[model samples]
Target: MSDDLTKAGCCAGTAREATDHPYEDRARGVPPADAVTQADLRTRLTEIPGGIFEMGTRKSTYPDDLDSPVRKVKLDPFLISPTTVTNAEYARFVEATGYRTVAEAEGWSVVFHLLLPDAAAHPHHPPGLPWWRRVEGAFWAAPEGPGSHWRDRADHPVTQVAWYDALAYCTWAGLRLPTEAEWERAARGGLARKKFPWGNRLEPEGRHAMNVWQGDFPRHNTADDGFVGTAPVDAYQSNGYGLYNTTGNVWEWVADRYGPRPAPGRLPERNPTGPCDGLQRIQRGGSFLCHVSYCDRYHVHSRTRNDPDSSTSNAGLRVAADL
Candidate 1:
């Protein structure tokens, strides 16, 4: 991407205009298009006040593909769930609708190699990233394979859910995905634009604040954060607005399609929603697989994209509702 576009956006993941990014392909999710309406779905939500703040990072330790342009933005008051949707919550939806996620329909999803109890593979991994293994029958219900379920991690955020799957849940639960601007705003947790949700310092006085890769990437994971995979949805201290884990655990889906930020010299934004259209959708927050040595998107304000139909073990959902 050009310096102009890079200066217009922020995040560890970048969607170049002409780049052959994997996410550009058609989404593969199989959730029905119709939104479900039945139960009164409610969650522990944090009320965010209206304010002005920088939306992107001015500087980052990780390479940004020119997506870290710091820009001023204004937002209206809103309410956001403090934590992501948990497995127990998602199970309720499945039980109600007999929902078959994209992964279930596809019969396979990407699973991190280290998470598996033993070697099980068909060997279709992402180019340049071989640690991702395509395992059959890997869906939200069976995160690791037929043997794994959410019983142990019931309180943890649900994973192996595609963007379409998340929207379906939001519709059924009487919620909606937050826009990119709103996500960044809530992620800041009332702080001015900083590297992370908590503050500028990654570990305030040398303690792992959230679940992220503590050791090497794709190889040796010390798991010093007291987790080998997803942690409880409400693991750490709440942010200024009472939100948790805005920077780590799993990438949260947002409402907007992926596109470049407004070019330089544009007016300061008010509820900015990115470009008119694009191939991919926005994924805010980083995931368990992220590390400074490889993927440093663990920093708040960083953004990424994926096919709306694709699901992976590391990707999950954080729902938002209209208040």
Candidate 2:
């Protein structure tokens, strides 16, 4: 947490080092995979009748993320959680398996500077991303360093969970992370080429559709969406397919790997899983921190990447299963 901390390697040493902050030499450990029988998941997972859909966007918001070269993607029917994994759901996994998240194993994680209870007390800033702070003792259980806990936000989507942590939870819950194409198909909510799940308009009829930053970035939040950090999993209206918080609340980790933009003339890919040798994984949907002024990746086609062991205050996961 000190300013003198230099950039170090991540939990997955074979992968590239994290550019954000220094880390301890913790070996990447996989959580124990439990039996694949989740009765509770049967009721929570919504069936998505999959088919071919135009993936990506022609009107690319962030061209470098490769949100362009729209392609036709086909997927078989699958079941997905209506919302991101909630704190209560994750608690069950922790209590049953006694598993520890990567953030907890590393003894620290990234937290938004403003979300810190005493931002002024934390003088050091993360590299490149000055809006974030490398907070000691920040993990899924205690989100805002040591003082804050997830007890009050049990219904909210669990954050500060690394991609590996999410995979562990999915393995324990008898589920899997959705493919990037599958995620986009479900997030579209049956709409075609729309910026949002609802439509092109961010706010339809002057009503907030999802939880996103409503004010100037890294400065002030109007909380016009009724939430500054995270909202309840089902806080907003469900999408056309009865899915909630598909576009906002948290950046959801998908099953695909991160790669460069596709060639413009390449043919359609059937159930693409990104490049076979790619390292970092892809995160879709945007988080509550997303704003037009700064990180406006809340739209359906938008995406970003992070190492498998990366965890933050605004990232979480949604589970998917075979139908």
Candidate 3:
């Protein structure tokens, strides 16, 4: 992979795995057959009225990302959580079901090199992406590996979760991961053909709207956005729909698989779920690790994909339900 692709992938891009990894077989997961939903789950969700909105971009920055040829997408009304699942929220799920995350089961997950207290101790790096380090014991609870704890970051979006893990959480809650079309609709916040949830300008009125890389990516972050890592899930201004941190705090797993996108004229008119079968699942928005210089995927229309079994420090989940 090229350096740009590798670096972008390190943020919201696909995960590169080695064939010899010990946990390869154990990474896959399925929702529990007896999953139950909490009665109060919908009370905290924001209702999105069904409608048609333009999807994709006419001005494409990354061609390979396939975010072009703007098309109209119609969605059914649905309810979505205002924020990505928080560390505290996920802890409740784990405690209730005694569910073990893939990272915890496999003994390791990918972590940002800068988050490591001693980067040298974890010498393994994914090929072409030295910024990503394979760290032992780096699950959602121990976000940065063994010594780090999620107690202090209870409000922050939970990370190091695989797509299947998100699915498990959704099933248990009687909710589901939002379809890629639904995600874009919620992220757009009723806007039309804009680059971001708020508007085209990134930092509207000289104020940082979301959490994203402020300085140099990978090597240095100026922390101009008041965060170096994951921000509180409720951090930054809520979009028009009252959804918080939809783009830059972390990449959120969606229901669709990476696609054989239909031609613009052939696009599905109502709630398109993308392809029925694929190896990788779609993840929308971007992460704290994204920057214009390397990975500019924080926009509402932006997207990327990774293997369903892959786990990373900058990926997370949000829930949606039929209204």
Candidate 4:
């Protein structure tokens, strides 16, 4: 489950008992789960029905850890936030709780060197990925460097928040991080074996569905999707289940600790929760910097690992709840 932040870059919804959106798994005759509406779904939480679905991939997926072998994962009904927490939302939590993020405590964080202003220079680089740079005071509020602020990005997903920080936010909000299995199932959006959340095609019929690197890797970004870095949480189309930014946004922290897939040729796992213990926790979804030519780990099944206290320009969180 160990992965490199050298690659992890970082980056909501409402309504309906999930059963209403059976269109996602209609092909397999998957019926909706019981209907129990949660009267007060925080701001924007979608109820994802419990059901069995495939996890991991069988086809080609690059930069894929490959440690998570293909398996069937069954989940119970639960409510989950469709988008990652926005800066405005996090600010509210901070104002109410006087909470300080790990990045703020450390006084520095990693930012894409390309994104930082010229004055915010740091000689350090992660070898081949020179785009990543350490900057002083580059937490979520100051994403690029000390000069940056979330004022202009109030609606964008909050970045530079570590796993411990995310857990803290969840605790304050009475929410929890989705387990790796729950995350994959939600990201799948009820579709079967598709590459991206939408389908096998990256750009269906020549239309960009989500935000990721549009041009060359690191060197350039065409911004064909109208965004170069992080886009609004709901920037693209939702999958059949109506979850936004499940893929190709920011690498989101999940509930599982880093672990290897079961031994080769093992049976399918049921409600699998990752390994007993590890230094790094799991992160799902790729970031704006993910390019097929380089990382290519932005697909639905893609995942990586990072230190629980690590924060960067590309990491964020999505909250979930039990139903």
Local distance difference test scores for all models: 0.72, 0.79, 0.82, 0.73
Quality of model 2 by C-alpha lDDT:
0.79
> Which model scores highest in TM-score?
3
Predicted candidate 2 versus true structure: per-residue lDDT over 1-323, tens digit per residue: 22233332211111225444222222123344454447666568999987888888887766668878788888889999889999988988889778888778777777777788887766665455566777878899899888898998999999988777888887777778999998999999999989999999999999999999988877899899999999999988998888999988888989888877566445567777788866578899988988887778888998887777778888899999889
Error of 2 at 273 (Å): 1.2
**Minimal lDDT window, size 10, model 4:** 12-21
Every model: Cα RMSD to truth:
6.1, 4.4, 3.9, 10.4
The top-ranked prediction according to lDDT is 3
lDDT comparison, 1 vs 2, better candidate:
2
Q: Write the per-residue lDDT of candidate 3 for residues 1-323, one digit (tens) a residue.
A: 11112333436422534233333233223333332346577678999989888999997787777778788888889999999999998988788777787677767787888888889898777667778887878899999988899998999999999887887787667788999999999999999978899999999999999999988778998899898899999998899999999889899999898867887776547789889876777889999988989888889999988876678889999999999
Pitting candidate 1 against candidate 3, the one with the higher TM-score is 3
> How high a TM-score does candidate 4 get?
0.84
**How far out, in Å, is residue 277 in model 2?**
1.2
What does candidate 1's lDDT look like per residue over 1-323, in tens digits? 21111111222111113444232232222233233243234436677787777777776554433356688788888777888989998998788667777677667776787898765444655545567666778889889878898887999999988777887777566677788888888888878756787788989889888888888777778999998788998898878888889988988988888765765446667877777877677788888878877678877777777756667787777766556
The worst-scoring run of ten residues by lDDT in candidate 2 lies at 7-16
Ten residues in sequence with the least summed lDDT for candidate 1: 2-11
Q: Model 1 scores what on Cα lDDT?
A: 0.72
TM-score of each: 0.85, 0.89, 0.91, 0.84
Return the clash pairs for model 1, or none. Answer: 6-66, 9-67, 10-67, 11-302, 11-303, 28-309, 29-309
Give the residue spans of candidate 4 off by over 4 A: 1-43, 59-64, 263-268
